[model samples]
Each structure stands twice: as C-alpha cells, then as structure tokens.
Target: MELKTIEELNQIGFEKIGEWKINKRGALDYEITTDKTTEVLYSFVKVDNQKEEIIYIGKTIRTIINRLNGYKKPGNSQFTNIRINKEILNLLKSDLNVNIYLFKCNDVITYKSHNINLAAGLEDTLIKYFKPKYNLHGNQRIIDDVELSENLIKLTNDMNDDKNCQNHYLIEKTTTVSNLEGKINLGNVPFSFLPEYGEIINIYLGDIVLQANFINGNNNGGNNPRINCVAIGNWLRENGINVNDNFYIKICNNNSFYFSINKIY
Candidate 1:
C-alpha cells in the first residue's frame, strides 16, 4: 500500500476516467468515457506540464459523476465538498488541469455469505500510503498536507446535512451594513432552523449565485449564527443593497438557494 506516484496507479490498473475542470462561471466540464453509473475508487491528480501530483483519493458507491457533481455544487454542510470545490476552482483559475482516475474492484471476496467491498477496504490503505493532501484523518487533520489550518480541519461533524433534500425552505433576512460587509448575522434565527455550522450555502442575487459559509459567532455554541460571504458583500454593494434592505433566501429543491432583494435600498 506504499503508493508514491501516479505511475504506480497506472501500473496497478487504475484507468484514467477523465480530465475535470470548471469554466469561468464555475460550471463542471469533463469528458468521461468510463461507465458513469458504477461504484469506484477514484483519485484527483493535477497535471502541470509533465509533472503529476495526486491531490485526493476517495471511494464512492454513488458513481463518479454523482460524486463529482457533489464536489461541484456542495451543500451548506459539506465542508469537504466546499473545500475541494474551492481548491479545484482556484487551481483551474490558475490554469492547472485536474484529471480523474477510477478503479473498480472486480475481484470480489465473500466472507460469511456477505460480499466484501474491495474498493472500500483498499481506500484507507491507499490513502495511508499515498497520503493525498486533501484527505482528512477523521476530520481532524490533513493526511499528508500540513499547511491546512487546524480550524479548517475542525469542521462540524454534520458536514453534509441533506435531509429533506427536495423541500424548499424560505430564509428571509434584512440586509444591514454588517451584512453588506460580508458577515451576515442570522439574528434570532435558531441554529436548528438553518444549515449546520461549516456548511456552504449558495445564495442567489438575481441571476448570480454566491457561495457562503455558515458559521457561529465569536462563541462556538451557536450563540450567533452568521454567514461569511465576501462575494456577496461586493455584489450587494455593487447592486445598491444598503442598510435596512430586505432580502430573502429561497433554498431550492436542489443543492442551491436563491435570494431576492425586496427593497433595493
């Protein structure tokens, strides 16, 4: 399980699935030739010229495309999804190419009349050996990459709360000067009523969508729930959203939400 380089992956039969990238508008772009519906153990590698670096390794029973979609449009509670999406977007913005490789375990072993998932079993071992920089050790620390901040690794346990995934919830808030400055306080809103801490939510202002991170105030006991969205601050300022402007967030049936400025203020 001492996987050191990308060459080891190809030598061990991992197939290159596709090259993934996001457009300027942050849309997913890739050409996948493998079966899109099968479970897989995959890796994300960045290719610069002839150099290759494995950034992540993960196994998913939900197929490659579905998992990629999750990374592309992460939910409010999906810290890893949000983190990886940001990493991918930043790298793409710098013109780095990320490629994906998939491995399907056809060699099955049965134990006690139950089929063993080789892909699942091998994931940890490979991660331990390869130690992809983005892979976290039980949400505590990055496996190989130590540069990530400790606070970032300490995200909420309920990372991807997708319950009632199809229901649209309305979250209304009035814009304050503080909100327009990027720190939005969910005044008097119960913690249980909003997305969990460390969640990344998509807020729409007209046709534009801004991704924001939900967090607690100076005290971490959900004392004051707030959202951190620098983009929203710029958008609000640019669009004449001032103090006392009313805005409402409409959580969509999908993994996104939209907001409208009731009063342009």
Candidate 2:
C-alpha cells in the first residue's frame, strides 16, 4: 500500500497500519513469517553495543516478519542480503541485539501516497534520507559525499605505490611502554604514506590535540620516516582509541596524520 494520511480536507479514508514487535528469543532457530498480508515494510535493526542507534534501515516487499526471518536461513541467493545478514548474525552471536522493526502497509486503505511512485521509490527515498549502514547496495545520494569532497581537498598519497616502493623501510628497536591509561608495544610500525621523517604530525582529537615527530630512517638513504607506538598510543588515548586495538596511521598531508581506530581482535 502507498503511504497515506487520513486527510479530513481530502475526505480520504486512510488508516495507518501498525507494526508490533515479535519476541525472537525462543524460536531463533525456526523460520519466521508475518501474521498480516503486508505489501510493504520498513525494518529497523539495532546491532549490539548500539542500543541507542538503529544501525540499519530497510524496506521489503515481504511482510517485516518474513523479511527479518530470512536472515537466519542459508542458501539465500541475494548476495547483498546474504552478506549484510552475516554481519548482523555476527553481531547477534557476540550478544548484540539485532532488534527488527517495521512499518506496516496494507492494500485496502482507501487513500494513495500523493505524487510518489509508491513502494520502491519510497524505499529508496527512505534509505537515502536515513543513510543506514547496511543499505550498501542500491542507489545512493552521492551529492552529500561529493559536497564533502569538494570542501576538503583530496589527500593524494595512495598507499598502493608506497607499499611497493623501494624507499619503504621497516625500522627496528622500537618499544612500547605501558602507562596508567594503557600499553604500547615494541614493534616496527610503519606509516607507509609519510614521505619525510622527523616532520611534525598533528593529530586532532576532539578538543585535545596530540603532536609527534616522524623519526627519520637510519638506512643509507635515511629517507623513510616512522612514528612508533609510544607516539601512536598517546595520540590514540587522547582520541579515545586503545593502543592494543588495530588502527591505521594515515598521512593525509605533510603536517597532518589521521589515526583510524579499528576492532580489537
């Protein structure tokens, strides 16, 4: 059914179909389906550690119940559904909540969605507007991303060429010491994208800023510079990233490096 409001002025007999939650705790292993003959549905899922966040927003031609139930089954031919649901199941296995929500739509409602092409078009619009994580497939609102790129000049040091370059060196004898906050390790960490050593690396962490030097290489050319864990840990700590967690040291420009935090294991 197309979305419609019960407009008094238009004399349309529109009633909003409602979604009720199903407790999946007991029958998680079983196939699930819907009670209603729903034509359109919106699913809202909250992955673990994100109780406040609806990590994914989705719409389906099937009823909300049947669609969410499809995740538990194997041999799904839709590659995107299979791929994204794997992530969802992982989150669920880790004791994270995958709360499925839906918006109800029915055929007998005596009103029409004004000027909208209806179901599929509305779904696309909702996906773009919400920017949900799991809707990686389908049409995207590239305008927002393009505008962001326009605002920030492209940082050009692509790591592929840097990785294969002869100038890349892995310096040794580096150590990580533990502080009250956490620990740093003794390892040869490479900031492969940096072109020069002993140069200032400015890391902006919210209101706090951390600065470190890219120590020059001791090789014959003495060209490859690196910033170790001691510097990295401190910078991450200031920015709320743990030292033990996997993170990347990205050199965006000469004066700045972006430290991206990844998962612990």
- Residue pairs with backbone atoms closer than 3 Å in model 1 (clashes): 76-199, 76-200, 77-159
| lDDT agreement with native, every candidate | 0.63, 0.39
Question: Residue-wise lDDT of candidate 2 within 20-113, one digit each (tens)?
Answer: 2323662234222444544343544554453434455444434455555544442222343456557765665667655544444333322343
Query: Which segments of candidate 2 are over 4 A away from where they belong?
Result: 1-34, 47-50, 107-119, 138-265
Best lDDT among the predictions, by candidate number: 1
- Show model 1 residue runs off by greater than 4 Å: 138-265
How well does each candidate superpose onto the true structure, as a TM-score? Answer: 0.53, 0.36
- Residue 98 displacement (Å), model 2: 1.1
Each model's number of backbone clashes? 3, 3
